[model samples]
Target: MIQKQNPENERIKRKFFAYLQGPLGRDEKTIQKHADAIAWFEKTTGHKSFKKFHIDQATKFRTQLQTATNARTGKPLTASTMDGQVRMLKTYFVWLSQQHGYKSRISHTDAEYFNLSRAERRIAHTPKRKQVASLQQCKRAFDLMPSATLIQRRDKALFACFMLTGIRDGAAASLPLSCVDLDEALIYQDARLMQTKAAKTITSYFLPVDPAYEVCFIEWVSYLQNELLFGHDDPVFPKPEIAVGENGFQVAGLSRDFYSNASKIREVVKSAFTSAGFAAFAPHSLRSTLTRWADKHYSSREAFKAFSQNLGHESVVTTVGSYCPVDEERQGELIRGE
Candidate 1:
């Protein structure tokens, strides 16, 4: 049976979305996640009115969620996903309880019930070790890939670009030709034009790697400028071309426009790694590699602070806490040296 929309719930959601967008200044992605969380709650409750919510309803929903299985995996939902659902719901109810009409019915204190137990919260918050490719591995991946055709060259260059600069994949996909200075070896991540995290305009210098990696980047840029006659306003990394084939539309060559999103770049990363006989690493993992590299190269607090800023971190602590987890091998070396 299809669940019908609840008009009252819809109205409340609209108001809530407005509140999040305007007063909270949330980006669209955050707003959409909140909206999705609310939609799940509404579906579970048979599309009930928000005004009719009670503490028992919250408790029952929490119980239901604990038993819920992921549609794709057929396993119980992960603790972190459960935690996100509860957090969003709790925030929503807390806001609702303060509203004029809801104040009479819903108590703000009741919102606390939409929380995971202490143990579960700990599991959700714990950081897991991520896979990061070393500079040598990145070079191997780039060198191993075929670069005879236009698309192959683009894919190889794309991998090299990520390894060279450690720019976020989103920023890389949307980067304009003007943002890169081949002579200076600088990338001007202009947030106004590129899709940077939190719209941050970052000035990132090329990390010291094998000179061969820099050559890959420089040659790719030169191809776009001298051979292709691409102007500075064109995308630094353009999209793949589409052409009709016997079966259907097929990727033929390179498009002359920027990719609207980072999905293609992610695919390129996955394929490049798979071809080079390594476990796949996401583009963001390269940032961790760069951070760890910086940790080794810079011992002075002031120098580390500059390194943090180059990665667009407002505080050095943010870089250390989030990305500087020492591997067990490195930890052992430090202990042995001491």
Candidate 2:
């Protein structure tokens, strides 16, 4: 059910969304997090205005989040999840107090109550190893892919691009033909032209993976340019078109536009991994896979630099904190002998 409509809150949401898109320039992931937090707060308070926010409300939500269980996992929510949701609200309200018509009702200091305890934030922010797929696992999945249909070709191309470039799913979805220079084995992730993290621009040199992996991407690019007669300025992965056929509803062929969302890419990845006999892994997991690969091949600075550029991160430290955790098997091997 919709909360009782509050004009002020509704206006604030709109303003906040625009602010997020404009000044904040946050990634979709960050924007969505803020939206979820604001939605939860609106639901709790019946769409109460920011002017009515109080310390008690903030403290109570913290307690509620602690007791909350994840709907799918059926376990207590992770501290990271709770921390992000609460922090988004805290930051929003702090900004709200500085806005016109709300200075008296809200205070910048009031936002501090939204923070989790220092112990809780530590638990939330601690680095943990991710169980990313290994190079061997990726090769298995690729070998198992059946390239018999156009959809299949696209699926194979999707995985090939990701496995090689390690670009985020959204950036991959939004990539243009011109962005890809198969001749140079590079992707020009120009931030002015692409929706990259922090809107940072960089050229991603496709790392040397399997020879077959290189062929898969090169062939796909050629197919799009030659067989499909697409120019150098089209979407690398256009959305699928739907049509009514003799057999009723079906996806017929390419839609004339790129995907505005990354859902299709994620779906293709899940299907490919499942068909290859592995449990499902999200498209984002491939980043950790690249990180794992980098750690083995390069020393600390080199590894960090490669991982940072791959993820469009400007700082090596941020890349390490955000994405470079080694799996347990690697940990054991390193510890066992040395």
Candidate 3:
């Protein structure tokens, strides 16, 4: 049976969403996740009114969340997943405890019931092994990518660009040709012009990867400028233009416009890696690869700091703490003084 939503809950949810977007400065995707978390709590309570919110309800929700299964994997939700969802709910309820009608009913301390056990919290915070490509693996993938047509050339260039510069997928998707400097080997990820994380303006220098990757990227840029007559304002990686052909709608050539999002860029990266007989590595994994590379090559602290800054990280600690997780094999080797 379909459970009916409380009108009061819906009204307050809209207000909370606005608070998230306006006051909290959350993006649409993040706001949606917050909404989903709230909805999950509502579902647990049979769409009960916020005015009726109690400590027991939160306890019940947390207990159910512990055993919840992921719809996609058909496996029990991971500690991390449950942790995130619970945290979101806990935050929401804490906020609710201060709101007008909810203040008297929901105590601030009541939200503590949503927390996981100490052991579960520790497990949730543990970082999992990330899938990062080797520099050689990236080179092999780049070499194997066919560059027969303009689309193929673009695909190959895009793959090379990711390796040559550890730019995020969103930034790369919206990057303008003018932002790229072939002579300087730099990328100006200007937030005013392109999509950057947290609207940060980053100055990224191309990493010293394979020279072949740089050559491929340079040739692609030259082709766009000289042969295609593409202007500086055009997208660095434009979507393919679709036109009606004998077989129906088909890709004609490069479009002058930027992609609406980074979905296509991720697809290209995944295809390139998989086709080259490697596990499908997302564009973000390339950042990890670069981080690992920096760990090995940059002997001096100053050089490593500069390298971290080039990757758009404010602090070297942020880069190391987030990206430089040693695999178990490497950890074992290090322990043995190998």
Candidate 4:
């Protein structure tokens, strides 16, 4: 249900968003997340104006958030999620305390109440090893994806594209046919059009996976050009065409344009993995697989630096810091080997 909008709260939120965009230089997605955090806090406070904020309200909300359950899952939110919510609220309060109308009413020290206890902060920040499918497993899933219809063929090809290039899903969705260089086995993710993180344009070559994976990707290119009559400027992975059917609106075929977002690419990956009798992995996990593979294959710093660059990382540290969590099995292997 839509919460009743408070004009006072809404007006203040507009200024907050403006502050994030202008001085802070936060992106739209980041600003939106902060907006959501503010909305959640407002909801808890019965849409109370910021000018009315007090230390008691901050303390109460912090306690209430600990017991709060996810509306969708009906389970308590994870510490990391709770941590983000609290951080967002704290940042807002700090900012609120400095604002004109709120300054005298709200004290900067009151924002400290939003901080998670030390133990909770430790739990929230600890690195957890994320699951990444091996190259062999990804190839199996790609093969298992049926190509009975145009949509199936497109989905199978989409999975192949991810495996072959390790391009982020959004970049994959935004790829023009021209960006795919079949002769070079390279995908040029031009940030000029594609939604690359940090708007970094990258040239990623196909990984040293099985020949079959490359064949699948190559066949997809042929299918798009020859079968679908897609041109140089056409989207490499087009969105599904939706139309009214006998039952209701159903996907008919591949549309002639790119997906507005990467959600469909993610859905295709999840469904493909499930059908192949594997736990679903997000599309981004493919990058981790590639990273781990590089960790094993590359010994020289230059080689690894090149590997990082291929994944669009400006610095090797950024790549390793984010995706280099060794799983228990890998950790055991490393320990035993040495």
Residue 64 displacement in candidate 2 (angstroms): 3.0
**Model 4 weakest 10-residue run by lDDT:** 207-216
- Candidate scoring better on TM-score of 2 and 4: 4
Spell out the clash pairs found in candidate 1. none
Clashing pairs in 2: none
Task: Tell me the spans in candidate 2 whose CA falls farther than 4 Å from its real position.
Answer: 1-3, 9-22, 27-32, 46-49, 67-76, 241-243, 250-252, 299-307, 327-337
Full-model lDDT, candidate 2 = 0.82
Screening candidate 3 with a backbone cut-off below 3 angstroms (N, C-alpha, C), the clashing residue pairs are none
Ranking by lDDT: 3, 1, 4, 2
Candidate 3, backbone clash total: 0
lDDT of 4: 0.85
> Which 10-residue span in candidate 1 carries the lowest summed lDDT?
205-214
Which stretches of model 1 miss by more than 4 angstroms? 1-3, 244-252, 332-338
Residue 236, model 4: lDDT of 80
Score every model by TM-score: 0.93, 0.84, 0.94, 0.88
Candidate number achieving the greatest lDDT relative to the actual structure: 3
Best by TM-score: 3
Worst 10 contiguous positions by lDDT, candidate 3: 1-10
Model 3 stretches with alpha carbons more than 4 Å out: 1-3
